[model samples]
Target: MNAIEIINISKTYKSKTKTITALNNISLEIKEGELFGLIGPDGAGKSSLFRILATVLLPDVGSAKILNYDVIKNFKNIRKLIGYMPGRFSLYQDLSVEENLKFFATIFETTIEENYDLISDIYKQIEPFKNRRAGKLSGGMKQKLALSCALIHKPKILLLDEPTTGVDPVSRKEFWEILKKLKSQGITILVSTPYMDEANLCDRIALIQNGKILDVDLPENIVNKFDKDIFSVASDNMFLLLNDLRNYSHTLSCFAFGDSHHLVIERNKADENLLIQYLSRHKNLSVKKIEPTIEDCFMQMLQSEN
Candidate 1:
């Protein structure tokens, strides 16, 4: 059976004259043991979906099942079957790392030692300062502790919403490593994040924006599906150069990526030689063809969504 199944799930909030729809008939199925990712930026409904799966909220329309338990009607049972880590650090900060773990375990009427081995690898990293108050810990250590608390009960499914958003680079890598370790223990994980790079870490991903799923596929496969060719253009006047490129009818899409802007052209009509001479009219500039990447695909996806 699918670990999680969401069919035509839709949610909205209302206040006087304003009604904001958070999810728009979103549907997906995640197989057991798959590390599924709901990829999107802030306010794109990633957290809303996670909250619904975690049983903290109800969908206004449609249904969601976790392990065959309806998220709305069987919310209590569903809560006991999964662990959730919200986008923000919602753990009890005044409590020590060890205390927080104990608190969560106590909520489920279980002890940490009962499932010590399940979170042992992760707990070890935070064992040294186990007595330190959670609020005093750095971003990375706090994340580790939260993961430990979530895993203490060995829930069948893990729901993480933007878990690594504010953490440093090293910590982000470490956090993902911890997740992979959890995945190996026969647990299904549903993680959401805005980072395009993290899409490759999941077994499958649903790229979402404006409460809509643009596509669902492996990261590499999604990148390979870019219909238009791409090129990289950089110049001393990069800002002005991008504006000029965007004005051209031949340019399908253009977005700045680090030191270069990935440019999609309609056809060979705007090839390197043509672009070079056209760009030469401006100040110091360079243009070269380049392969498309996940970020490029995401950019194109966002463009199409608009």
Candidate 2:
């Protein structure tokens, strides 16, 4: 069964000076128990779409359904069946971790004891500090506590918006592990993140930008769509190398990635030898072929639109 359905949804925000379209004719289907990702940068409508599905914000046009309940009319029912964790931590900072969990459980007319098994693994990590005030906890601990409360209700669907942003690498890894465990328990997850590397963690992903979806497919499938041969190039002078590469006639695109620049070349016009000879004018330049990643695909998509 489809856990969520969005049909031609569009949302716009108005200010005294102008209007901004946050979502543009967006439509998608998320299968039951699937870990689906919405990949996009900030101001790219990821949050807007999540809010609409959570029934906390209304779209200016179109509609959406969560677990077959209409977001507009059956909001109360939808709320009862889903656990939403917004991009920002919204828990009570002054309350103790245990108190916060108890409060959310009560709001759902449920108790932590009733859903202990669902969140036990996560909750236990923070249980030692259960009496500590939420504001006093570390970023990672706060994340665990928030997730525990979300699962305390044992909802069928989980909507997490950038749950790992600003978190340490260890915490980010641990968080995804928790998500995988939850998926095993048959909970549908719709997570959004700006990190391209995280896109591979989901069963499928939708790439969004400027309030529009560029593509939706499995991570590998999306990477396979990149038409150009890519290479990693580096030289003693990085900044000049980037500028020179952009001026190269055979260069389809070049962007800095880590210590090297990722150069996508027109397949018909360039090869390793040609790239080497072309950059030989600069001393100590080195180039090597590299596999394209999801980030490469996203950049290609953005380039096409421009």
Candidate 3:
């Protein structure tokens, strides 16, 4: 059986004056022991979908099943088999690190000693701060504690929502390492993040936006789908250069990427000389053809949709 199965699932929130759709006709199947990523920004329905699978919310249409157990009908069974870590730190701020872990263990009728091997790698990092109140711990320390508690019961599937957001670069790297180790132990992981760079770390990723899925594929395959010559164009006056390039006849698309702007043009329109002559009319610009990254592909997809 698939680790998780979602069929035509959709969710919407209604209020006094307006209605908002959080998820729209989404369907996906995650393989057993696969690391799947939901890549998107805030309000992309990631949280809504996650809450549904976690059995905390219900979808307006369709159904979801975890390990062959229906989310709606067998929520308790599903809950027992999955470890869910919300985006925010939901642990008790007044409690010590050890106390928080013990509390969750008690809820699941499990002891830290019973699952120590499952969380030893992560729990070891925060053991030094066991006496510190959860509120007093650093961002990374809190993240470790949360993950340890989530895995305390040795659930088969792990659902982490934006676990690395607001974390330092080093901490993010360390967190992904921990995930890699867990995957080796035969656990299915479904993680969500807004960072495009993290998409490649997953076995497969689905790019989501406006409650809709733009594309779902392996990261390299997604990059290869970008079928255009991309060029990095920048000049002394960046603002004017952006405007000039946008108005240029051969410029198919242009968007600011980091310190330089990435521009896409038709196959035959990839002429450096022509681009230089066209942009020099406004300002002296430097241009070079560049490889398209996941972010570039995401932008291209969004542009095509518009």
- Number of the predicted model whose TM-score against the real structure is largest: 2
What CA RMSD would you report for each candidate?
Answer: 1.2, 0.9, 1.2
How do the candidates rank by TM-score, highest first?
A: 2, 3, 1
Total backbone collisions for each predicted model? 0, 0, 0
Query: What is the per-residue lDDT of model 3 for residues 1-306, given as tens digits with 9 covering 90 to 100?
Result: 699999999899999999999999999999999999999988899999999999999999999999999999999999999999998967899999999999999999999999999999999999998999999998999999999989999999999999999999999999999999999999999999999999999999999998889998999999988889999998888898888889888778899999999998986667799788878755556799988999999988888989
Query: Candidate 3: deviation at residue 289, Å?
Result: 0.9
Candidate 1 residue lDDT tens string, 57-125: 889999999999999889989989899999897789899989999999999999999999999998999
Task: Give a tens-digit lDDT track for model 2, residues 1-306.
Answer: 799999999999999999999999999999999999999998999999999999999999998998889999999999999999988977899999999999999999999899999999999999999999999999999999888888888899999999999989899999999999999999999999999999999999999999999999999999887878898999999998999999988888899999999998876567688767878877788888888999988988898899
Mind sharing the TM-score for model 2? 0.98
Give all candidates' CA lDDT scores: 0.88, 0.93, 0.93
- Deviating ranges (above 4 Å) for candidate 1: 267-269
Clashes of 1: 0
Distance from true location, Cα of 301 in model 3, Å: 1.0
Lowest summed-lDDT stretch of 10 residues in model 2? 266-275
